[model samples]
Target: MQKYSERKNSAIDKTANPESGNVQPKPRRRRTAVNRGLDENGNGKRKPRRQARRSRSGGFKNTFLLTGIEILGLSVAAVCAVIMLLGYSAGRFSGTSFFGHLLPFTAGVLVLIVAAALFLLGWWKLRQWLRRYSEFLTPALSLSLALLTPWLVTHDQFTLAYGNFRTLVGGKEEAGRMTISHQVYAAYRRHDAAQLQKMVNRAQEYRQAIEDAARSFAVDAHLLHGIAATESSFIPRDSHDGGRGLFQITRVPETVIAQARKRLNVEKISLDDPRHNAFVAAATFKHYLAEMKDDLFLGLLAYNIGPANGGLRFIMQQYGATDFTTIQPYLQTLPRDYPIRVLAYSLAFRLWQQEGRLLAYEEGNNAIRIQRIGIPGLRAGL
Candidate 1:
C-alpha cells in the first residue's frame, strides 16, 4: 500500500511541472546574406504577400478627384454641342468660320476625352474594389460603357449638321454666290478717241445686232451689255434649262418657235445663235416693261420667277418692306440670290458705261435701294 501511494504522488508531481506545456521555444531570427537557406517544409520560398497596394486611407481621395474631372469635362462637351446646334438653326450653317466648323470637332474631341477619363477612373476604382468586392465592378463597368453610346452618336449628328450648314450658306461665302468676270467689263471702259475707234470697229463686227435691238427697245446700250454678260457670258452659242440662245429665253414653245421660224425666215430657231435669242428676249422685255412701267422691280421679278404660283407676290410680301438690306435672312434655301444677282448685273452695266471695265463688285448706284435714294425737293423721304 505504501509503494502504490508513493508512485501516484510522483506522477502527479511530473504533470504539475512548469515545463510541461509552457516550454520556452527558440526565437526566429531574420536571414542574413551569408547564411540564408531553404525553408524547412522542403525548398526555400518567399514570405506570403501583404494586402493590396491601395488598402489604406488615401485611396478614396484619388477616386473622387478622377470622377470630378471626368464629369466637368463631359458637362463642358454637352454645352458646346448645344451652342453649335443653335448657330446652325440661325442660318449660320457654313462651317467656314473658325468657331462654326470647330463646334462639332470640339464636341467630338471633348466626348472622347471624357469617355476615356471616365473609363479609366471607373476601371481603377473597380480594380481596387475587386480586390475586396467582386460584385460591384462588373455592373459598374457595363453601365459606363453603355452610357457612352449616346454621347458618341450625338457627336456625329452635330458634325453632319455643321457640314450641311456650310453648303447651305452658298459655298460658304459672298464671293462664291456671285462670282465676277473681270475681262469683259474692262474692255467696255475705254474712254479715248483711239479707244472709241477700236470699240467702234469691234462693235460693228461682234455686236451690231445688240446696238440695233437697244435702239428699238429704248434700252441703254450698256444694259444690253449687262444682259449679254449675265445671259451667255458673251459666248452666244450655249443653251440650258429651256433657255434658247444668248439671252436664255425659255419662250421657245411650239407656237413661239413656229412664229420665230416664220419671222426670222429660219426653218428652226436654234438656241446656239446669239443674235436671234437676244433680239427675241429684248423684244419680250420691252413689251413687258411698257405695260408695267409703274413697277419696274415687280415686272422684272415677275419675268424671272414668273406669275405662275404667286411666288413673286410671296417674295414681295416677304422681302419688300425693309428694302433688300435684310432680305437674305428670309431665304430658306435657294440655289442663287435672284434679286441681288440681277441687280448685280444692272450695276455691271452702269459700271461698264462709267468705268468701261468689268469690276468685281460695284456699289448698287441707288438701283438696289431705288426708293431710298432721292432728289432733295421731290423726295426727302419719299
Candidate 2:
C-alpha cells in the first residue's frame, strides 16, 4: 500500500512540472468583452460614429457636385439654342409694317417655344436612357451641341440669316451702314475690268511696303492699298492738289507725322520714298479712325478731308452732324464719295487676295459670295 501511494504522488508531480516529459492540455481561455463586441456592461458596442458620418457626407458631396455640373452644361446648351432659333426666325419674318412684321414674328416665337420644349423633353428622356451606359454621356453630348452653334452661324447658308437678324435689331445705324455698303457695290459694278486689273498689277510693286506699314500701324493692308490706288493709281507722284506720294498725303497732323516717324525710326520724312509715304499714310489713317470713334465711313472721310478748314471733326461740329448720314448734307464741298471709292478699291484687292482674281460684281452668284467675303477693315460674313 505504501509503494502504490508513493507511485501515485510521483505521477501527479510530473504532470504539474512542465519540464518533465509528460504532455499537458492547455487551459481553455475565457471570452473577453472586446472579442465578443460588448462593453464592460455586457452591452453591444456601436460602430465608430465619426467614420459612418464621414462616409454619408462624402456621398452627399459627390451627388451635389455632379448635379451642379449637369445644370451648368444644360444652361449653356439652352442659351445657344435660343440664339440660333431667334436669329433664324427674325430673318425669316423681317418686315416694315406692324401686321407684316409683328404678327409673323410673334407667331414664330410661339411655335419655336413649343417646339423647343418638346425637343427638350425628348432629349431628357434620351439622357435618362443613356445614363445607364455612362454618367458622362449626356453632358458630353450637350457640350458638343453648344460648341457646334458658332460653326453653324458662320456657315454659308446661315450667314445671310444671321446678318438679316442683326440688321433687324441694328436700327438706324445699320440702315446707314447698309446704304453705304450698297453704294460701294454700285461703284464696284461701274469699274472697267481691264483698267481695274491694270491697277491691281501696278499695286504689286508697292505691296510689300504698304503691307509693312499697315502691320506697323494696325491698319488693314488692303485699305492702305485702296488709298494708294485712289491717290496716285500706284504711280507714286506729286499731284496738282498739293498732295504727294503713293497715298497723296496732305495736311497730316503733327502727332500723326511724329507717330509715323517713330514707327519708321527715321529722323526725317521724305514723301518721295514709297515706304515712307506708306507709313505716313497708315499712321494718318489710324489717327483719323480713332478720332471718328471707329466708324469705318466717318474714319475714311476724316482721313480724306484731313485737317484742312479745321478737319472733318470741326466740320461735323459746325453742322451738328452726329453720323456719316447727318454729315452727308454738309459734305457737298468736300469729297463726299471718297470713302465709297476707297472701299470699292479695297474690296477689289480683297477679292484678288481671296479668289486670285477680281470677281465681277454682276456675275452669277458672285454678288452673294463677294458680300459674304465682306469688305476688309470691316466685319466679314455679310
Best by lDDT: 2
lDDT of 1 by residue, 68-159 (tens): 65455555545454445543553443355657665755565576678668856876686577747654444455456546645643453444
lDDT of 2 by residue, 264-311 (tens): 999999988999999999999999999999988899999888888899
Model 1 misplacement above 4 A: 1-206, 237-240, 252-270, 307-336, 354-382
Q: Against the true structure, what is every candidate's RMSD? A: 24.5, 9.6
Give the per-residue Cα lDDT of candidate 2 at 242.
91
Worst 10 residues of 1 by lDDT: 373-382
